[model samples]
Target chain A: MKFKTDRDAKLGYWLILPTVVAISTLIFYPVFYNLWLSMQEVNMNPIQPNTFVGLAHFIDILTDLDFWISFRTSLIFTITTVIGTTVLGLAVALLLNRDFPGRSVIRGVILLPYVTPVISAVFGWKYLFNPVFGQANYFLVDILHLFPQHINWIESPAFAIYAVIIFNIWRNFPFAFLMILAELQSISASLYEAAEVDGASAWQKFKHITLPELKFVLGALVILRTIWNFYKFSEVYLLSASVNVLPVYIYEKAFASYDFGQAAAISAILFIFVLGFIMFYVKKVLEW
Target chain B: MVGKNTILKNIIFVVLLIILLTFVLLPFVTMLSSSFKPDNEQNTFPPQIMPENPTMEHYKGVLNPDIFPFLIYFKNSLLVAFLSAGIGIVISIFGSYSFARLEYTGRAAIQRGVLLVYMFGGVLLVIPLFQLITKLGLFDTRTSLIVTYVVQTLPVSLYMLGNYFRTVPESIEEAAIIDGCSRLEVIYRIVIPLSAPAIVSVFIYAFMIAWNEYLFASVFINSSQLRTLPLGLNQLFYTQHYVWGRMMAASILTAIPVIILFLSIERFITGGLTFGGVKE
Candidate 1:
């Protein structure tokens, strides 16, 4: 039944042709097309004359104070949040990795943050972090009596980023947990058995064997999460419209200011930053 | 043998589990309890984890036509999610099979290329995709979202299906071919049957991604009637501002289907995650 001639190769090409065409048309064309758009100034408003301004938008975006503020915010937000989620996720995964009481129910509950709609959580978080009547502050001031007056969680930029970070970590750690838990399960019981026979303590086995085995997954997840988190838009913006992150910054430029050119430029820059890691990840980590 | 260190280690694990479990459940408990309470009671001091007078009034409001186009939103979301899942799974099966099994020159190149396509962020394509859809007279059409969702969901589908297909022994396909099955027949009769679990897992995963998607649906589809649940819910939030009861009711309804499905298929989903993880 084997095709033993040149026709087989030809047939293979013919078979694959449609998929390649679809991929090119639906995927690659838009990517290359956006890259082109980023280069030229395309006025979103029909009234304004669309002009080609070379690299001006990128220059302007790079120099803009608001843009830099957001870039810094994104950096801090991405780093701290990712570290928080990964550490928390690993800890939980380790705890749940063993046979414990109520394990099945606890596992299901762990997925809540990942399962809940972003908008729902964002809204709930906003209400919880409300300066005046928010529940978190109420619990803090009224019950715990930690803070006397209200704390504006979403108003001040300093506190706003932290609130959003908390929300992000909460929503995302489950994803990390899922992956880490899967990895934890796969580690051979024999390795721990052998380690114990060799007089290795639990901490020593985890530190030497478990952590080392998890390195690639941890590296891959952190990279992927960082890229996703840095470009994370909806949660932060939805929580407070004023928080300036890269995605929101793009939204403002594209939608609010109606400056499609600048927005496209910023998008291109962010894509490059995000895509750099993606390419590395796909090439080295994912290894298709 | 029973040392202080062993006791200390056990205590640490207990403490960590307690904190983690609390973090996981508290917000949701708060949300669920608050949903049943009256509007004024949503922000009560000390935060009622258990409603004083638990009632279904908020649920009624959420289902009210004036509050939300609940039925319409539900129907639209169902249609969108089902359509995308169906379309995404079919296209990816073929595409991923070709990448996994069929041998030809440039196979590696194409695989890498598809993986690269996976990394391309949605934000970058938003403008052009909108323009293309508009030019195709699909602006504000469900078709626009459906077609665009394929682009978003395709990569993960391909990766999942491709990896699954690879794990399937080629000898089975060869034997099927020898039994006079055509290429198409071999796939339909053998491969598809063998990969049902993977296919189901991919469908559910892709559906969730499409189902929970908000930003694109919000941006691309403008008509309230055409809005998906996420968009519909957001619109409700915007208008009502802080009506916690109604919001939670809608949120709970929006989340119920997937949650129920996940709970039912918890074994399959976790199994898939484990499978995908090992390969990775």
Candidate 2:
């Protein structure tokens, strides 16, 4: 309040006016509009208006097998990828915490997968998992004899979820890595030295110091990643047609099936769940 | 700091580093090598680590107007991303300055409200936005994408730039005010100049979000001629007899510009994006 003049208040409101306007129209309105749409049978005709259906779309979706499949898939993908990325990110962060030549360069390289566009990363993996030409099968089956045969990894319905999970891990772990590494570097070196003064083993020091220090960041990371992975679209959608996570399911329901009402229902369902998660997370992890 | 048995330990350390890096870099290597690989080499089993006979035909194939229409897609992506970044930054810069510098009623609540909206996934917004766009008759135009992308970017841009602005020493600003520089002029002349790295980072973040967007572009931009790069790449892949080489080449071209921009400001981005990470 240093600038307590009325002019300062005026300026602040004026400054945020455009932002408030934009978000209200573009984000806030759409979120509530989606709820309304979920309750309506939207008409395709330009002249004819949408009609109220009063929970019919939700009932229809809840009864459908496909919606259940997507719900299950979203849960599996979110949990597995959240755990996978956190573990991988923690490992890399710990590894890179120690100094070596070209450390910064390696750190930058690790971030490439996360920072690059999803389309490119998916294309790269598509080549890796290509049935005939992919190097993944060639290396695993032919070179190392890890698998009995080349599996149709991305294309097959049975294994495509795993491919999506693996790709999600590959693309997202670096995000966790970047955050954890920042936290890891911030840990006081003096504390580690104090532990070492008592002749503590590496495992004891890590268990006593590192894990405890990482608990909050890891908790927040898991929450954020869960929310994100639950709503993940482009990664799974681009990876394969076989994998139908919730967001992809919504996209198909709306655009592919031309049933915007059902799609809105799915979105409404997802929004409520996410809102509940965020509220709980803010209260618990964020302590807001 | 070298101790006894240092040789074995160093070897193990180097080996571990290599193994970790291999996991990260192999996909990129595969993409780059495959891009250079001719069709015969690309389709060969036990995919080549390095193309023996590198060729530009794949790049040419993707660039061909009839085959991929690279220019139109490229132009669409460039325009959308550029405008999104431009407008988002301009709008956010002012809002963020107020957040960092000024105190006003309801500011904290509004800030939290924005972050809350940030967590709402694009999937939630896509349906209603599509409906609105169609109703407004703005569907299938770059204008629809430009405005949507700008709004999509606002929250993150504000958060990042606001964080950056808060760190500018108050004493410097106070001196400027005492010397009679108006608040807006101080922002224009001093704040903007001092925060170059952060501005670049925010701009790049907004640009890349727009650049890599797929969900909205897929639904909103229905016409083939109006498609952005992600849509174009998706179109290229979903068609019959899609060539691996050409797809990889196009992927490389699409990603290279963003990677270069980001790497140039890697240090600045770490502070902004990872303060509490937000992803596109």
Candidate 3:
């Protein structure tokens, strides 16, 4: 089927105009504006005009120990959560992938944690880990005697990161499970059958047949999840303020301290890290 | 003669499944049960899994205006979700059609550009978007949230719709064209009907994004009157005394719409989500 080339081109531009315009003004423009703001002293007071400071904020951020700490915290949070969610998700996917009764029901129920509202999930966990009255403390301290005292999961900086990681894994593993399960369902059973006929052990069959087939999806999930968990703010912030990942650090800088320039600088640095993943994602995962 | 090995393996699988299920559901069950418990019972020593005497008092408290304006936040969230989905779907339909069917300069590049930009983290955009919103005098307004959500959701919505559009048989549209149907007529008469499921999925996806969104809502909206559910819940959690039952009730209320949405479209979710990772 053919159309008049000139007319088709004209119609195409017209059709895509709204989306292009919206993306330009809302996404691209803000991104460039963010870069410009990163180099300026941006006081929130409308009376104070932003003055270009020529990378001073970036230098300050680079030198700051707090920024480094937050970077470390972000790295730990992202790495742990990505690994935790992926491993847990894969384990569950393998379990559910087998022929079983009520598997579909179990799959649906498993996704509840992931699909539930973040605020709700976070608050629920906060209540569960409430030091004084949380069920977790009740079980650990009173019932099981695992600890002598109620551990303040949300407030104490020592344990808060772990709490946040647990919350993240619980909330996110379903996504990994869903993806891996989809891929798992696609693998040809004949390979496993052939391996079994060759007198292979169960582990050998899985190692030989399953792992290689899952490599691409797993790679994509890890990279994508790494990019996402790096900037994850709401879940961590809502769960605990003590565990200051980079996003929370930047938020505090901008909104709490009113240091827009420094915030932009930190964000600019964060953008570079995110851009690395985005490039990998575009080239490697999407292959676009 | 099936051996004991099969039964042992089955037992292990069941045990692991039960453990995972409990880990996943314990918090939700705790929240729901606590929401029904009376205040005194909620803070008991061995936090009870089930409220012995359930009451609607906390639910009543949630509805009380003097306590918290729960309904207002609910309405605000619904408005934002629906408005974004409505406006976003319309724009994405045309945009996706262009990408999927029409030959145009920069079409491929633009589509790829949208995908890359879509992957840009929201935290990086917060400061500039805030400034942009304030500069445009849209701070503390629903319009600001709606506009930002449209931008946040458009790329993925276009991607999903465009992917689905490609799956629609091109031959149908060509047949229409040969019958002298204009492109606009073909879209209206033929394309849309065939693409209804994807449109619904995209609409639900956009709605879910707007509904669950916290960062943009928190930044752009400051007025108590304009607060969405997540922000409102956060404020309630922090500002007031710890009322576990009422807080749980509010949390449950917040999740109901989303849970219902998911259940109805359970199948489409994985396909849509992994089609592109749920943006933010």
The digit string of per-residue lDDT tens for model 1 on A176-285 reads 88888988899999999899999998789989999999997798788778877876777777777666888888877776776777877888888888878667877887
lDDT of each: 0.77, 0.88, 0.88
Q: Rank the candidates by DockQ, best first.
A: 3, 2, 1
- Candidate 2 lDDT tens digits, B5-89: 7888889888999998888988899999998988888888756798999999989887788767777888899999999899999
Question: TM-score, B chain, candidate 3?
Answer: 0.96
- Highest DockQ scorer: 3
Candidate 3 is scored at a TM of 0.97
> In terms of lDDT, which candidate is strongest?
3
Worst 10 residues of 2 chain B by lDDT: B271-280
lDDT of 2 by residue, A232-270 (tens): 999998989789889999998888877888899999998
- Candidate 3, residue B222: Cα displacement in angstroms equals 1.6
Worst 10 residues of 3 chain A by lDDT: A43-52
Clashing pairs in 2: none
Per-residue alpha-carbon lDDT of candidate 3 for residues A28-146, written as tens digits (9 for 90 to 100) = 99889989999999978734688889989989999999999999999999999999999998999998987788988899999999888998998899988999999888888899999
Q: Between the candidate structures 1 and 2, which one is better when assessed by DockQ?
A: 2
Better of 2 and 3 by DockQ: 3
